[model samples]
Target: MTDSSKWFESLRVSYEQGELNESDITHNPFEQFNLWLQDAINNDVPEPNAMVLSTVNKQGQPSARNVLLKSADENGFIFFSNKTSDKATDLKHNPHCSLLFSWLPQHRQVIVKGKAEEISMQDSNSYFQTRPYGSRISAWVSDQSKVIKNREELEVKVKEFMDKYPENVPMPSHWGGYLVKPESIEFWQGRPSRLHDRIRFTKKANNWTIERISP
Candidate 1:
């Protein structure tokens, strides 16, 4: 096993602090999610909003990657990336997706399952313009997920972009955001004896149906 695998295998902490219950949760899943996210922020979990975004290709193969959570509202979670990338291409064929957020230190985890949709161009433009100069330039340089010849070639193109744009870097045509409209969300809280607690909220008609699940 790798170092990381051995590290997990040697974990000794017995989670005994929290438990998920209906009364402890917000009526609205989105609001509850935001609250948990805020806690993650407050506790300074590494990359608090960073989540694993999973998508399925046309051939039914699953792929995933770490992506920053840019925004979240009543509609759902949002993250931005290259529209021409593998994840985006997979999204085009299979719009369904999953976003997993793990707060290991807090013994808490959240999973969101949803359908992906493109945000408005106006929204994309706004977010793009706010990014740093280097990031904006990298967005222009990287084709994302595409095969590259070598590291030198990639850096060469990046350097060219840097030289070309001595001032501000304009947003690339292929970069934008995708919103995940969640149909269901599950929140887990670790407890003693490995008897964890899980609360699930599922979208049914216009309202959400909340239910407790065995953990």
Candidate 2:
């Protein structure tokens, strides 16, 4: 198998579903995301808040995973993960990270690069309580990113936690929230013939500069 041949293999679709015009869009990147998110909701795009979070360790090894965007604004996009997880460890060592949201149904994508910060424990508790009981229990049971013997051991832990706390579970101290404060945010809309629309908002010493990018 050759790499170039595999790379050219296609499950391609012509992006005729959505169009982007210079007339419609907000100056702020967050505002644009909010508009797109609302459209996704209206169109019944499944799990529209979900986005790919990319992080790197101190050694510059990058990792990525799909995570739900719990919050977003000028401060940047927010998501939560276990403090003991590899992602958390990586963030501790390197605060810079990026997030990508591909709203394919709308033929759109957004990319953000930023520095991450941990939010208050009080905030974590508030969101934790909103999660389903099973999810809360799973957070307690799983030693996220840690090595376990097998599924049986994990099941045992879940069972033990469930039996001990049938109705309510307190949010773990180590489990909390993190926010990414963006340095730059780009909005991309797919156009025909591989000529895409890309608009970028870059932060400067005191202001944000907007520019159109080559696709």
Candidate 3:
């Protein structure tokens, strides 16, 4: 084997940071998530609300990308993106998706499985208004997931939009938010000796069932 291959195999971690127990967590997965999220923030985990959103297209091809979590509550997790983007197109065909929040510094991860649905236009506009002026202007410039000629073309379009909407930029019709209604949420905490703790909460009817699963 090559020296680089040997080096890769030699790298390992013991994961002695923490342990997760069933009795220690709240019955509500959302509450548990909040607690862990706060811990992540307290520990200075970068972009604590960022999550990996996984979606599958109609043809069974899978795609995963990082999206910032805008809000979370009993309703579910909310995020925003271009409505015409590849992820949005995938959601239109198949709403079923998964979200992963990895706090590597804390040796913890949260996995969420759910279905995504578009939020109201009013909500989208509310969030859009809060964004910075440049971001709002750029939103109107690029047609997400579409091919463009070059960087110059993109910069020219941005300039055009900036001049067009000099002061107050309106929210584009093609931009919106999505709510992922979670069906199952699993909290994973790494432990020593390659063993980990996993606590899962599954939704059934109007209540949630909690259980411990093998790591």
Candidate 4:
């Protein structure tokens, strides 16, 4: 095989897009996050709401995957998935999790440390009804994260679910949303000479404390 180490070392980019200063950021982490998210959207970054969710299982083994951020506010962030999925299982065992938003095109990233809890079924159903018909059907068909024979098996089940719910598809009991209440949020901005800017906001008793950390 080709020398992959050389290929990896040969790739490099100088980050000079912007600089983040404490004076430039909002006092509230949630507002700051929204500002960066809006910047990503304005820059035409694909899937701007996509975030990496990291969770640790009961065994302390960590796992991470990208999931779309369905909503965010002062309450925290929200995302949905199959209740029986591996990530869900991880959350069930360990509520503490982390979320990462990487906007590489803009040379910025946001990290959130939080505790995730299941949202009310009523809220989940409301969002579920808004999904496309095919998506709703797929939710019922796939046992997400479960082993199956092959693509044919999944496709067969898909067809069956489609036939069963040709009209209004009801949300599956196994599928729902989780709300993550953040305890801390950090924003990182890439800079020249690898001297990145790091700003972190820690939540205290009904207030937030901001600090600038060394790169």
Candidate 5:
């Protein structure tokens, strides 16, 4: 095998940054998530809102991509994207999904297994209006996941949209937000000697039950 392959097989990192205890976590997973998220932000973790979203298609093939967490509440975690995108298509075929937030710098991670559903048009419009003008234009430029001939094609579309909506770029019909209503959320903290900490909260019948999970 090549040296690069050997290095990849031998790479290892010790988990000794932190620990999680039952007393340190809130019973409400949302509250606990907020605490960890804020800590990540305060510690200068890059793009702290970025999360890995995993979705499975009708054929049972799973895919994962990084998306920004735009909002979170008692209801669910929200993110926006083109409805026609591959991920969106997978969601339409199968709403069940997973989200993972990795704060390696803080030796923390959060995983959410959930169902996804689109937000209301009004809410999508509200968020779209807050986006940068260039972002709005870019959203209109590409039909995400669709094959294009060249970069010039996207550039042309961007230019066209930029000229069409010079002032306020309206939210495209194909663009909107989805809320991931978590059925279970797990928090993980790295501990010494690979004895990690895991706490999980599961929702059932409008109530949440917290549990300690073996790491």
Candidate 6:
């Protein structure tokens, strides 16, 4: 085997940050998520709200990308992007998706499986208005997930949009937000000797059922 392969196989971490007990976790998965999120923030974890979003296309091909979490509430987790992008196209065919938040500094991770739904235009615009002017313009300029001749072409498009909307750049109709209504959420805490703790909550109707699964 190659040296890199050997190094990869040898790399290991003995997780001893903390232990997760059933009694310590909140019955409500959302509540537990908030508690852990706050803990991550307190621990100075970088980009605590960042998550890996996984989606599947029509052909059953899966794709995963990192996105920043904009908001989280009883309703669901919210994120925004171009509705015409590749991820958005995947969501159109398959609304089902998974979100993973890895707080490695604390040796904890959260996984959420859910259905994606578009948020209201008002909500999208509200968030859009808060973004920097350049970002707002770029959102309209770049046709996300499309091929371009070169960087010059993209920069030219940006300049055109910037010139067109010198002030008060409007949110494009194709750019919006999506909310993931979680059907199942899991909390994982790492332990020594690879004996991790995993607690999952599954939603049914309006209630949730909690269970502990093997590590």
RMSD (Cα, Å) for all candidates, in order, is 2.2, 2.4, 1.1, 1.0, 1.4, 1.4
| Regions of candidate 2 where Cα sits further than 4 Å from its true position | 1-10
Q: Any runs in candidate 1 off by more than 4 Å, and if so which?
A: 1-9
Q: Estimate each model's TM-score.
A: 0.94, 0.92, 0.97, 0.97, 0.96, 0.96
Q: Candidate 4 lDDT, tens digit per residue, 1-215?
A: 99999998888888999999988899988889999999999999999999999999999999999999999999999999999999999999999999999999989999999999999999999999999988999999989999999999989998998888889899999999999999999999999999999999999998999999999
User: Tens-digit lDDT track for model 3 on 40-112?
Assistant: 9999999999999999999999999999999999999999999999999999999999999999999999999
Error of 3 at 120 (Å): 0.1
Clashing pairs in 3: none
Candidate 2 per-residue lDDT, tens place, 36-138, comes to 8888889888899999988899888899988899998877788988998998999899988898988888899899998988999998999999999999999
Candidate 2 backbone collisions, by pair: none
What value of lDDT does candidate 2 attain over all alpha carbons? 0.88
Q: Model 3, poorest ten-residue lDDT window?
A: 1-10
Off by over 4 Å in 4: none
Write down the lDDT that model 3 would get: 0.95
- On residues 47-124, what C-alpha lDDT tens digit does candidate 5 reach at each position? 999999999999999999999999988999999999999999999999999999999998899999999999999999
- The global C-alpha lDDT for each of the candidates, from Candidate 1 onward, is 0.92, 0.88, 0.95, 0.95, 0.94, 0.95
Model 6: ten consecutive residues of lowest lDDT: 1-10
Model 1 gets an lDDT of 0.92
Query: Cα miss at 2, model 4 (Å)?
Result: 3.1
Please list all clashing residue pairs in model 1, or write none if there are none.
none
TM-score of 2: 0.92
Q: Runs in model 3 with CA error above 4 Å?
A: none
